[model samples]
Target: MKKFLTLLLAVLMIASMASCAGGEGGKFELGLVTDLGTIDDKSFNQGAWEGLVQYATEKNVSHKYYQPTEQSDDAYLTGIDLAVKGGAKVIVTPGYLFEVPIFIAQDKYPDVNFILIDGEPHNADYSTYSTSANAVGILYAEDQAGFLAGYAAVKDGYRSLGFVGGMAVPAVVRYGYGFIQGAEYAGGELGLAAGDLDIKYHYTGGFAATPEAQALAASWYNDGTEVIFACGGAVGNSVMAAAEQAGAKVIGVDVDQSSESATVITSAMKGLKASVYSVITDYYAGSFPGGRTLVFEAKNNGVGLPMDSSQFRSFSQSDYDAVYAKLAGGEIPRMTELDEKGSPSVVPVEISTVTEVA
Candidate 1:
């Protein structure tokens, strides 16, 4: 009888441990909802997940990620529901695509905390904007990152440059504008006439790596565009393919894309991993800055070029450091204000040749 009682007690203890491991009674603390991509996208999704995984692994907490079934409001909402149902206390949503879904989720999951990266919560039609006490919005200074790419490309002796953007969205526009500004600044430093350095700029209207984008980029390379800055998500892949064929260089975007293609010289990166990590740390420390929107910029080490793998012969790390300091110290003007048409008002170079390819 004594042996049977001891065995029964061991079984009960094992069952309790299993219940906790199964996420019963809210055992999971961290959750991530991927935005329109897989966790290994090597872009936005990967960057954010690296942060979440790093934090959770360090703290030895329970965490999981949910990928939406499709790219729609209902699909993303269902993902959030699943994450919350799995006992997630804090959720992180990556990308601007999650804006509307998160807007709804803030109220639906009132008890759960949310960290929305790259955008704020907004209505479907953008008629209303709100960030509840349970949510925090995060944005990055894409212009600064773009500026570094342009500067590095020009300094590396690339006279003719091209920019292939995904769309004329605010983030893409800022990158384009800053790239042009940096090219003009470098042209002045090199004493090159404005006409001597030409820039071909176009928006691809979508983010997919379509053959159309590849053909467009190939045509630009054939027309003597030395290096093209691919500023979109998968659009960079298209540009890289064309660059490889044309024996030309390419500038990557969003993350360190040097590993993606040999044609890529460097990438303009945002502090996605760092920013997400900081937010998670804050949430755990009970200092989550909820009910507010946060912007990451050069002043906060938020934007720059990846120099470790950059193939620049003339642009040394010290040169980059000097320029970064100027930008960070506010010596160089930031392109923050936009015009009525949502374009940067001040472009130092003549962009009369910029064509919007359909």
Candidate 2:
């Protein structure tokens, strides 16, 4: 009788502990739904995943990521459904592509907290927009990141440059415009003559690393373009391949790619990992900023360049900090992806000839 009582008590204790560790419904308390790319793409997905992994490992929490079978609204929603079914209390979705799916999923899974990066929730037509109490939207100052890359490049003596963006998406547009602006700012400091700088800009129409992107990058390098800002997702891989062949320099985007290639001088990084981690911290602390759009900018360490790893011959860490201070203080002009006319336009610089390629 005594043994039976002891065994029963032990079993109850074990069950209670299991229930406590298993989270709300399943095993994972945190979840991530990748956007159109694998987690190892070393871009948006990877950056967000790193943040989740860092937090989960530290707190001994269980986390998982779901990859959609296709890039579609339905597919992304299905991924979200899987995460919710797996007992995720908070789900992280990277990129603006998840805007509509999250918009729908927020209502469908009102109990699940969502961390939507780079966009806010909106309907398919974008006429109606709302973020439920369970979701928080995240946007980065991509322009600031791009500006650092361009400023450093010109200061390091790169006279000719190129920008090959994946698509004319808002984020990409912002980076492109900022890169041009940063170069012009540096040129003004250097008192460079007008037309001494040439910039070739093009959009690949897609984010995939097509052979065409590589060929175009190679052409730019051959035509005297010194460094190219690869602002697209996998499109950076195409540009890196071209740089390897031409022995030219390249600037990476989204995350640090200095380790990915020898030709990569620096990267325009969205503080993806930091932003995601901070939000997850808030979610677990019962202070998640639901229905709020959090903008990460230089003022908040949302964007920057990996100066320690950057291969700049002239640009130093002090130079980076000085410019970064101006940015954080809002000395630079406010960069917007679209002008008041709702069209993409570059505030042209007289020193550089920007040839926009179709």
Point to the candidate with the largest lDDT: 2
Candidate 1 lDDT, 1-358, residue by residue in tens: 9999999999999999898567655656899999987989988999999999999999998899999999999999999988988889899999998999999999998999999999999999999999999999999988889988988888888888998988778888888888887887777778886487778888888889999999999999999998999999999999999999999999999999999899999999999999999999999899999999999888999888888898887999998998899889988797877543434335656522344344
Model 1 stretches astray by more than 4 angstroms: 1-26, 339-358
TM-score for each candidate, following the candidate numbering: 0.89, 0.90
Give the best candidate by TM-score. 2
Error of 2 at 191 (Å): 1.5
Q: Which ten residues in a row are the worst by lDDT in model 1?
A: 349-358
How big is the positional error of residue 34 in model 2, measured in Å on the Cα after superposition? 1.3
lDDT of 2 at 288: 94
